[model samples]
Target: MGKDAPYVLVVGAGAVGTYFAARLWQAGARLAMLCRSDYEAVCKHGSFDIKSPHGDFKFIPEAIIKNPSECPVPPDFIIVSTKALPEIDVASLIRPAVHPKTSIVLLQNGIGFDEPLAAAFPGNELISGMTYIGVTRTAPGRIEHIDSGRVALGKFPRGISQNAQLLAGLFAKSSVPCEIHENILAKRWEKLVWNVPFNPISVLSRADTSAIMAHPASRELSRSLMEEVCSIAAVAGFPLQPGIVQKNLDYTAAMKPYKTSMLVDFENKRPMEIEAILGNPLRVAESHGLSVPNMRAIYALIQLLETGCRH
Candidate 1:
């Protein structure tokens, strides 16, 4: 790592990227973001604010690359927090900001990218991470963190490496708790454990966390979806924690009144992450010849809803 502030680049200026960048920069990390020139609006305005689940902290990035070309030198670390579908272009975007030693942290919500991403940027260290915090962009350069959660990293292609540990350690130092997960894939699937049920159904039904979980039928449906997912995960060698169903229900209750990102996208008519978030798991389950009726139903509804929105 650089003796001076660590040079880090965030691929997307979306909610997750913005929240983490602000906190890391506040803690004395030199940050750069990969974004379009339009985002320069924040540059002129100075910085943005976050109502962190922990206390809020604010800072301005030293530079924001319109793309990789703007970064003349590779960053000490690169964190890509873009939505799943857009992740297809990460290798191309991070080229300028990546060296053999640059550690890449992916915050996208899905487990399918483990091998593909590592293959895309071979020789560079990779860390698979999951954060449960819910955040929304109130405006350009401004984010609201409704509730906070820990970030888990490690147990990736190279689990116990110093780079992975360093990545986990830096995030642990942040306001939210952080830990090294021995089985990051299981952790990733565990995140999907809730998302499979909550995200798509919420988006399609136009319900927030509270509305979705409060209703009996919908809540029961959520549990069935979770059980189906846990079954597939077990077959795929990623065993979920016991009581995942009840835990998710309890989580939704405690994290009540939260609006999932998919819900936000549906309301805004923006492209949803169904392909990477929902479709990926469904496909994986089918390949194993597993039954996932509940997920299939939710996935089908989200597809129909997205088509309706577009039309």
Candidate 2:
């Protein structure tokens, strides 16, 4: 890499983080990773084995440290791709490597996921990223990419910036369709139109995308949930494009039979992102006095399911 190559520290080296990190590395960014569960296996192997539709590749970062404090150098970009559960204090987790000029990129899911980080690092630029992809870590140091890898990004609380463009350019070069939006929060909410229903329903029904779409009752339920999300988004001043609900349904119907991230977490006996995907949007509906019965019901059931998993 050149002396002026962008130094990036991926804070969560899970499936999403590892895949994107590998792509950025292909785009000529200097990479360092702060990993957790896969640390031992990755260290032993010296790289991650990425299986993808784009192409198979071995991703060897410049450094792989178990803690943020162990990061060898200050990074220009800090990518956080962990599950957006309430317990994770992402701001503090990456604080050790956040330089004054570093751009913090959040690649997780959730409404208002960037607020805490923004509050924690008031001086640093926060890039809000919404990824539309199906990738998972099937084993330690091994990732399986199923389908789709497009991403939309923007500066938090709105508008584009140089930092956003630089990051988007990297992904674009790596063959991932990357969009820089003037209002990324709208993009986030639009994604929630798909996530809010499918993720939890997958867990509750023990079904993949194919199974869910194949059954008429579950299919309609998914549609209702999506419409409720659209209503909430519009009330919150981020109205979606017309026919978005049907568009999402059609897309999912054509998608390969695959498990959702939440379903995978549930089957692994791990905490699902119930609060992030469901709780946050439901709160928005309540605050706006909008009635979203389907959303409310699903949220309650998923929270119950998550609680059961914990014990």
Per-residue alpha-carbon lDDT of model 1 for 121-232, expressed as tens digits?
A: 8787788887777688887777888766667778465356676676555666676577787778888888888888888878768888899888999888888988988998
Off by over 4 Å in 2: none
Query: Residue 302's C-alpha lDDT in candidate 1?
Result: 86
In candidate 2, the residue pairs with backbone N, CA or C atoms under 3 Å apart (3 or more residues apart, or in different chains) clash, namely none
Compose the digit string of candidate 2's lDDT tens values, residues 54-87.
7899999999999988888889999999889899
**What local distance difference test score does each model get?**
0.78, 0.91
Against the true structure, what is each candidate's TM-score? Answer: 0.91, 0.95
The residue ranges of model 1 lying beyond 4 angstroms of the native Cα positions read: 1-3, 51-57, 86-88
